[model samples]
Target chain A: MRRLAARVAPPTATFLAGTLLAELLIRALGVSPLLLPTPSAVARAAWSYRETLLPALASTTGAVLVGLAASVALGVLAAIALAASRWVERAFYPYAIFFQIVPIVAVAPLLVIWFGYGWRAVVAAAFIVSVFPVIANALAGLRSVDPALLDLFRLYGAGRLARLVKLELPWALPSLFTGLRVAAGLAVIGAIVGEFVGGGGLGVVVLGAMRQQRTDLVFAAILHASGLGLVLFAAVDVIGRIVLRRWHWREEIP
Target chain B: MRGSPIVGLAVLLCLVTAACSRGGPPAGRVALALNWKPEPEFGGLFEAQRTGAFRRQGLDVEITGGPGAPIVQMLAAGQMAYGIAAADEVLVARDRGADIVAVYATYQTNPQGIMVHASRGVNSLDELFAGEGGTLAVEPGLAYVKWLRKRYDLSRFQIVPYGFSIAPFLAEPRMAQQVFVTAEPIAARRQGAEPKVFLIADSGFDPYAAVVITTTQRVRERPDEVSRFVTALREGWRGYLEDPGPTNREMHARNPEMDAETFALGAVAQQPLIEDEFTRAHGLGAMSLERWRVLGEQLQELELLDQEPVAADCFAAF
Candidate 1:
């Protein structure tokens, strides 16, 4: 109970302070409600569609998880290739930069056109947004393998696969986890943006709420997205901490 | 020959109110949010504001210009006092129980027009909507997309969502021109991508671009304020039609990237539409229950009219 109270205290206190300020602002302005909505109004909007929002949350969650899983696999494979050869990263880095510069808003419509409306398009968008962080982080992790350790393993005539499993994978875990945390949030945004553009799911609800000035629903969707991002980031952090706690050598390298 | 006594009295009351003394009772400060960038399109609001006509009617007016969603959010949240939005959007919001009241019409007509790359052998509306490979630039929303999907079979065409940017149409030959008859074509000529255009409103779309809407609470609390805002807005619109003056310069100041001549041409092209008999005959901030019903019915047929209160419920006549 104390833990729960400690956890909940800050947000509750923040809300009390914020609401007091928001209400005072609204009353003082004598302005029409056509422009800036009150905090209470935003809360009400979040409440009104909590039921429908649950399903959208589920869809977003599914997209983010699937996107992260694919991103991790692709990133790990690329990191392995880059660790083996410098030429591959040099050749492919420009292509990655190209995709990075191209805004998601521009490519989303074409994805909708080619893939039609569904999770497939959402996953593609999420993947596009998520893959970069994992790749970039994993590349850094792979290259950061302690050269002295690599030399010691090479002295024992360790095979490439043995060296990777014994040394590289463990060292890369923390960086890979960091990349996962970033991917978690971005994947959610990409999925929602995909839906916002392509028209469906939680994104449509948020867009509809936005159009009609339903601050409550917008807040509700946003709250869920933020919560999901935090949860994903925390989950990755916990795993990293647990794994990193096991070895002094890995902890010392950082 | 047919003026009923009661009707005549009502007219007399209206005239008396119109001719009431110019001195204001210290009007409340009201913000007027805009639809799209400030240009010849917003001539009336600027005119009323600049001429102090709103002040005459007991209003301290602030004019803000932006797209439909943000403006509506600002208005509903009480950051703004009053605003203009698509009449259909106001109705849609009302359906969701967004307490908005449509006060008057800014454009007697909507200027949403679609254009084709003239070199693509598409010269008419029928040709533009007939087949595919040509991208149709449109506002990113359900109303227009649903209408296009329901009204016409667009299986062969690639529909590119528009962000109100002209670059897509200006650069690509295969791209169809999508613009407000008031804004985009003027932008096109400067870019040297002159395309044959089809005005949807002229063809068969009843789009009201800049509609003056107030909060329902505002209507109930200060009927007098709403009336003055409308009158002032109408007066300003009338002034804009007579002489645009530095309105283009003001618009350019808002978006320095905008070309002055292109804006002027857009105004010239738009003047014929803005000064139509609708505003001249009915009054500037007029609402057509008839047109609203038509849009509602058409939207329903398109299957895009999400369940809301009836279209008429979202609006009122002054």
Candidate 2:
């Protein structure tokens, strides 16, 4: 209990203090609710609109997870292939850079046109924005293997596949986790942007609320989106910690 | 030179001149936020600026473009002097503790509607509803959509999301999409698709559109300014209806996304809607309490309102 309280106390105290200051300042200044709702008002709206907010949260979270999974799988495979051949990297890496440089807003409408609306288009948007980091980091990890280790594998008559499985995979795990942590946050943002153009998420709720001048609901939607992103990032961090621990154990075994 | 008598005298004269100028306030600087870009939907405001109607009232008005919800938010926050919003939106805003009052109604009838391809053979509302269930691209939870569901039996149609794009509707011939009666039909025709339009106003649920809104604080504190703004807006509408050529050219320059044909179509479609019986009886931008009452009652029945607002309190007649 003491350990948990020590961990929780700072954030809880900070949040309470911030809320108190905001409430006092808004009341003292006679600030208009339209400009910025009081924290209590936002909490009320969040509670009242939970029925609508829950499904939007589910839809966006589902899209982000599916999209992140696709980016990881495709990114890992492409990195392995690119590590094997300099010729392939020279020919195809420019396209990956191009994809990363292109803004998601410019591409979301085109994705809607091609993939036809709904979650498929949203996933494509998420995938487009996040896949590059995974590929670049994983490729660097694979290529940065020690020359002495390569010589040892060669002396043992180890094939390329065997060497990659034993040596490169272990070496690449930490870098891959680093890329994924970055991509996880980006994937949530991509999903929201996609939903702005394509529809069906908290973005839709925010847009509708803004149209009707419901500032409270708009803030509530934003809060939900931020919470979703935080949850996703935390999940990725926990998974990374577990995987890195195993990778360290495997290194010790050798 | 810093402390000489001549320098002191010059500085004194400068301060006196500055005080005189500052003491006599310049024309009350006001900003009017419009519902959309400077299209015909907002021509009255542009017309006001073009013809110096606001200047005549001792007001230097800045007409800027924004979406309806943000415009209302700005108006309620006292960031803007006036804004354009729908009557339903005003009612909602008022219910949510925004002290906004609607003073003018530009579109005497709501111009919102659904457009379907002529080839789909859905010419009328009943047929469109009774036909085999197909997708109608509309934003869910819109006031109109909720009202439509309450007013009709529309279980057959499945509403997919619409993001203000005509490309999806063009790609799927069977799809019916929400559109403004003045805007989308012209764009559709230009794209070589003949669409059959159904006006939401024709269904007898007529809410005012492009309503000129201002805060109750402004009305109470500066009633004269509020009155002048509303009157100028009315005159501006009348002037635009008489001849929209120069005013529209100026608007097109500001909003190049709309071309000549779209502007022309909007002017033609909006003229009849603007000069209806209520406007003719009172003046341009006139609204009736009876109509607002009916709308409020309907909204109450639809459960859109947590508590019914007194309709008279929602608007101020000039």
Instruction: Please give, for every candidate in the order listed, the TM-score of chain B alone compared with the true chain B.
Output: 0.85, 0.89
Q: Encode model 1's per-residue lDDT on A113-180: one tens digit a residue.
A: 56654677777788888888888888889889889999999999999999999888888887888888
DockQ winner among the candidates?
Answer: 2
lDDT of residue A80 for candidate 1: 80
TM-score of chain B of 1: 0.85
Strongest candidate by lDDT: 2
lDDT digits (tens) for residues B122-231 of candidate 1: 76666767855656655444465566666667777665335455666776777774677777777777678767777766656675667888888888888877877788
- lDDT by residue (B236-277, candidate 2, tens digit) is 888899888889999999889889879978888888888888
Q: Give RMSD to native, each candidate.
A: 10.7, 9.2
Candidate models: Cα lDDT each: 0.69, 0.80
Which lDDT value does model 2 have at B160? 62
Per-residue lDDT tens digits of candidate 2, residues A35-108? 56788888998999999899999999999999999999999898998888899999888887875788887677
